[model samples]
Target: MQDDQNRLNPSPRQESILVCVSYGPNSERLIRRGWELANAFQASLTILTVDAQDDNQYSEARETNMSLWESLSKKIQAEFLVAKNRSRNVAKTIAEAAKEKQVTQIVIGQSARSRWEEIAGDSIINGILREIEHVDIHVVAVQREIPLQQEDYEPGVQAYLVKDGEQDILQFDPPAKDAVQGLFFQSIYTDFNNGVFKVTEPGKVTKYQIFDGTVTRKLSETFSP
Candidate 1:
C-alpha cells in the first residue's frame, strides 16, 4: 500500500487537529479559526459539535447552519473537515478523538468567562482543558467579531492549488511591501505577462492561471517528489 511514488514527500505523520464547534453564537467564528491553525501546520482537521443540555430545540437550525458553513468552507481553501455530533461526554469525546487521530494540536475558541463560571455553567471548552493534557493546544480569540468571507479577507495561513497552466511561485522584488494594497491578496503584473495573481506575503506572486484545481504539494520536482 505504500508505493514509493505515493510515499514521496511523506508528511511526517501530519499532526491532526481537533476543532470543537459549539453551535452557539460563536460556532462559525471558532471554525474559521480552526481552519486557520490547521492550514498553518499542514495538519488535518476534524470538526466536532457537542450537544449540551439546553432549553431550545436547535437541531434543525444547527444542521442548516452547519451545512451552509461546510459549503462555504470549501471556497476558503481549507481542507474541509467532516462534522461529528455527540450528546454525551463532549469533552471526553474530543480528547478521545485527539488521541485516536494522533492529533498534535487542539484549537479552541477562548470564551469570555472565568474558569469557575464556565465550570458551574454549560461550557464544553473549560471541561476540555481539564480533561485533555496530552496534546499541544492553541486558543484563538474571536477578535474581528465578523466571520471571514472570500470577498472580505483571507485567512493569513492558507494553502494554494497548482493548475496545469499556473506559473507556480513568482519571484518579484517589490519596491516595498506597503506599495501593495493588500498584504497577502494584492495582484501583480508579472513583467507584462498579462497574468495577475495574489501577492502572497512579504512579496511572492502566485499567478491565477496555472493551478489546475489541485492543491500545490511540490516545492520543486527534483526535491519535492
Candidate 2:
C-alpha cells in the first residue's frame, strides 16, 4: 500500500525556461513574457542570443542590443548567454543550448515571414522542433503599431564622432582620441551628411541627429522606451 501511494504521488518535475532573442525592439517583450512564465512555474530563466559573426565583427546596433539584453537579464536574475554560430545554423545552436541548460520550455518571437514562407520549410521553429524532444515551445506573436517604412537615408557606414568643444562632429576618417565609433546614416534627400548617428556605450544606446556633420539633438529623446 505504501509503494502504491508513493507511485501515485510523484514529485513535480522541475522546469527551466530559455528565451531566444535577436537585435530588435521586440526582444524586450519576449523577455518579459519569459519572465512571467518563469515566475509562474518557479523555474530557472535564461536569455540566449545567437550571433552569426564574431564578437569583434558585430555591428553597433547588435552590440547595443546585446548590452541592453544583458542588463535586463541581470535585473531579472537570469543567465545571459551569447552563442556564436559560425555555420549560421541558428536553430541548431538554440537546440544545443537548450539541451546544455536542461531547459524544459522555450520562448521565441514569431517569425515576421508570411504563412506561405513558413509552410515552405524556411521557419526556424520547424527546425527547432525537429532538433529537440520533450520540450514545450512558445512562439509569441509580435504586434507592430506601424508598418515598416522605406529607408529615407543611405546605408549606414562606419563612422566616428569627435567632440569639438561643445558640439560633436561626424567624420568618416579613422577615430581620434576621445572619439566615439558608431554607424552614420546620411540622408539621401540631401547632399550633406544629415541623418542619424548611433552609438553604444557600456549599458546604454544613444542616437543623435546629425545635420551637416554636426550633431543637432539627441534622437533618443523621441524614442519610447
Candidate 3:
C-alpha cells in the first residue's frame, strides 16, 4: 500500500519556459499565454526577443514594444532578455537562449507569413527543433482581428497633445510645458497629420485617434494597439 501511494504521488516535475516574441500586436498575447503555462506548472519564465539590427536602428514601434515587454516581464516576475543577432538567424539565437536557460518548454506566436511564403522558406519551428533536443514548443495562433498596420504610417516623431476646451489638439512643434509628450505616426495616405497617437508608459500603451491634427476621441473610446 505504501509503495503504491508513493508511485501515485510523485514529486512535482521541474519546468522552465521560454517565450519568444517580436514587435507586433500578438506579442503581448503570447507573453500572457506563457505566463499562464508557467503558473500552471510552477515553472520559471523568461521572455526573449532577438533583434537582427542594432538597437540604434530600431524603429519607433520596435522600441516601444521592447519597453512594453520589459515592463510586463517585471510585473509578471519573469526575466526579460534581448539577444542581438549579428548573423540574423533568429531561430539559432532563440535555441541558444533556451539552452543557456535550461528551458524545457518554449512558447511562440504563430508566423504571420502567408501560406505560400511558409511553404517556400524554412519555418522557424523546424530550425529551432534542429538546434535543440527534448524540448516542447507551443505555437499560439495569431489573432486576425487587429487593425494596426505599421507600414501604413510614417516614422514616429515626438509630438504633444494639448487640451483645448472639450477637445485635444495635436501639435508637431513644441507646445506648452504642460502638454503630454508621446510619439505620433502620421498616415502616409493623408496629407494632413492623421494617424495613430500612441502614449506608451510603463506596462501600458494608450492609443488615440488623430484626424486632421486633432484628437477625435477620448482614451477610453480608442484601442490600445
Candidate 4:
C-alpha cells in the first residue's frame, strides 16, 4: 500500500493539506487520517468546519463536538478554523479556505447521502470539485454511528414531573392544580421514570432529564420562582 501511494504521487511531499469535517463521530477519523497524510509528507495541516449560523445558535451537542475537534486538532499540531456561511454553501466556504491556505491536497469524508438524496441537492463533494482547481481531493469513507437501543425506558408519553417533598417524580398523567407543569418525553421500554422533561423559560424551552425519579438542577432552577 505504501509503495502504491509513493508511486502514485512520484514526489511524496505535500506542502499544505486541509481536512473538512462536519458534525458527528466520523470527525475524529477524518482528523486522524489527515494527520497521517500530513505527517507522511511533512506538510502543514488545517481542519475546517463551516456552519450556517454562529456557534451560539447551535445545539449544546454541536458546540461540544466542535470543542472536541479543536482539542484534537491542537493535539495533532494542526490549525483549526470555523467559518460562518450564512448562505449554507459549505463547499464554497471550504473551497475559499483551501485557496487562502494554498492547500495542495484536501481530505473530506464521503457523503452519507444516497444517490436520490444527492439528486435533490447536489452533493458537497461535487460542489467542492467544481469550485476548486488542481487540488487532490481525498474522499475518506466513514461509517455511520449505530444508534443505541432504546430498551432502557418506556415509550414516550405526554407526562409531567411533580415535586414530592425534596424529590421530583415523573407522572405520566396530568398534574393537579398549581403543580409545576412541563412536557415530559419518556424513554422507550422501561418501567422506571426517565428521559427529558422540557419546560419553557423566559424566551426558550429548557430540557432537563429525569434520572430515576428526580428533577435535574436545570429543571429546579426554572421553577424556583
Candidate 5:
C-alpha cells in the first residue's frame, strides 16, 4: 500500500504470466489459483476477459457485470487484466497480450479447452499455444494455488571466498564489519570475481582470513585467525 519506491519494483517479477477468464462457472477458481501461483513464483498476473463484444468500450460494462468476481481477485491481492472482444478473436487478443506483457504463462477458462480435439482442427487452447512463441500457459480447474507458510526463522551471517576460479593475494585484513561482516549464505563480489568475506560477532567479524594476489603475503598459509 506504500508508494512505488517502497514496493521494490514488484519483487523482480520471477515470471511474467497472464490469465484469461471466460467468466464461466470455474472462472473464480482459476483466478484464485492464478493469484496463489503468481505469489509462489514471484510472478505477475494479467486477467483477460473475452466475450462476444465487438469493441473495448462496452468491456467496462461487462466487467461491471462481474464486479463480484473482480472483488474476489482483489481479496487475494492478485493482479488481473480484463479484455473484451468478439469471441472469434478473443483467443488471438489474449495471445497478443501475452506477448506484449512477456507473459511467462497463461491461465484461461475451461470453455476454451477440448479433451480429444485434433490438430487439423486445433482447439482454442492449442491455437493459442501454437501461435504464442515465448509464453507458457497454465490452465486451472479449481483453486490450485496453495497458501504460503508463515513461519519465524532466525537469520545468521556467514562468509565465503570468491575468485575468478583462482586464489587472490591480499593481507588478511578483515572485511568491513560495520555492516553484516560475517559468514552468510549470500555471496558478495570482488574485482573480476576476486573477493573474500567472513562472519563476525554482533554482526561483526568474529573471525576472519583472506589471501589476495594484490598484496604482500598475498597467499597466507590457510590459517583461521
Candidate 6:
C-alpha cells in the first residue's frame, strides 16, 4: 500500500528557464541576470540566440560573439542554442525553442542591437508575449555604451595567455614563439587590456572574457552540483 501510494504521488515539477540574447555588448549583462533568476527559481536554464540569415552569412566577429555567449552560458550551467530563421520570424523562432525546452520563464534585454530592429519590428517584445502563453518574461534594462568617435580596438589580432600567479593573463605581443594562438578583441573607451579572447578546441570554441587585465578560467570549467 505504501509503495503504491508513493508511486501515485510522483515527484515535484522542475522549473525550466530560457534566456534570449541578441548579440551585443550588453549580452553579458543579460546572461548574468538570467543566471540570477535561474538560481532563484532553482530551474534548468537555456540560452538561445537567433540569426536572421544562414550560418554561411556570419562574419568572423559574429562567430566570435556567438562563441563568447555560449561560453558564458556554460559558465552559468545553462544549455546554449543558436538557431537560424529561414521562413518564420525571430520571435517565432524563439517561441519554438522555448516550447521545445518547456521553458516556463524567459529573460531578454531591452537594449538589443540595431540589427535586430532592422530584422524585426519595434513590436518584437509584443510579438513574443503574444506567442508564448503562461510564461513570464523579464525585460532587463541595459546601459548602452557610446560608439567610439575613433577606432578603439585594433582589428582583432592574434594573442594568447600565460599563467601568472593566480590568473591567466593575456599577452598581446608574446616574446616566446609557439604560444597558444587565439583571437583578441579590444574594447573601445578603455585603455586597459579588456575584451574577449577566443580559442578553438577540437570540435568547439572556448571564449575567455578579459576584464582590465585578468580573466577566470573557472567559468569555462564544467559546473557541478
The candidate that achieves the highest TM-score relative to the unseen native structure: 6
Give all candidates' CA lDDT scores: 0.48, 0.79, 0.77, 0.70, 0.50, 0.72
lDDT of 4 by residue, 1-225 (tens): 999988888964458999987765466667778888999889999998876656567587676657666766765689999888876566788889999999989988765333313433767777778999888989888765446552434444566677787766777667674455667666442234545677766656667656454664443334434
TM-score computed on alpha carbons, candidate 5: 0.47
92-203: candidate 5 lDDT, tens digit per residue: 7678778778887887655445421221255767677767876666765542222235211123334333332333223234554323323422112111212233344443
Once fitted onto the true fold, the runs of candidate 3 whose alpha carbons sit more than 4 angstroms away are 1-12, 112-120, 145-225
Clashing pairs in 6: none
What TM-scores do the predictions have? 0.44, 0.60, 0.59, 0.57, 0.47, 0.63
Tell me which of candidates 2 and 4 scores higher on TM-score. 2
Tell me how far the alpha carbon of residue 135 in candidate 2 is from the true structure, in angstroms, after superposition: 0.7
Ranking by lDDT: 2, 3, 6, 4, 5, 1
Identify the runs in model 4 with alpha carbons over 4 angstroms from their true place. Answer: 1-14, 55-58, 112-120, 148-225
RMSD of each: 14.5, 12.8, 11.4, 12.6, 20.9, 10.2
lDDT, candidate 6, at 85: 84
How much is the lDDT of residue 32 in candidate 2?
78
Candidate 1 Cα misplacement greater than 4 A, ranges:
1-13, 52-58, 73-88, 112-126, 143-225
Q: Indicate the TM-score of model 4.
A: 0.57
Ranking by TM-score: 6, 2, 3, 4, 5, 1
Displacement of residue 149 (Cα, Å) in model 5 is 40
Q: Candidate 1, residues 41-118: lDDT per residue as tens digits?
A: 777776655445353555776665466445435544444443344445556666666776777777766652232235
In model 4, what is the error at residue 86, expressed in angstroms? Answer: 0.8
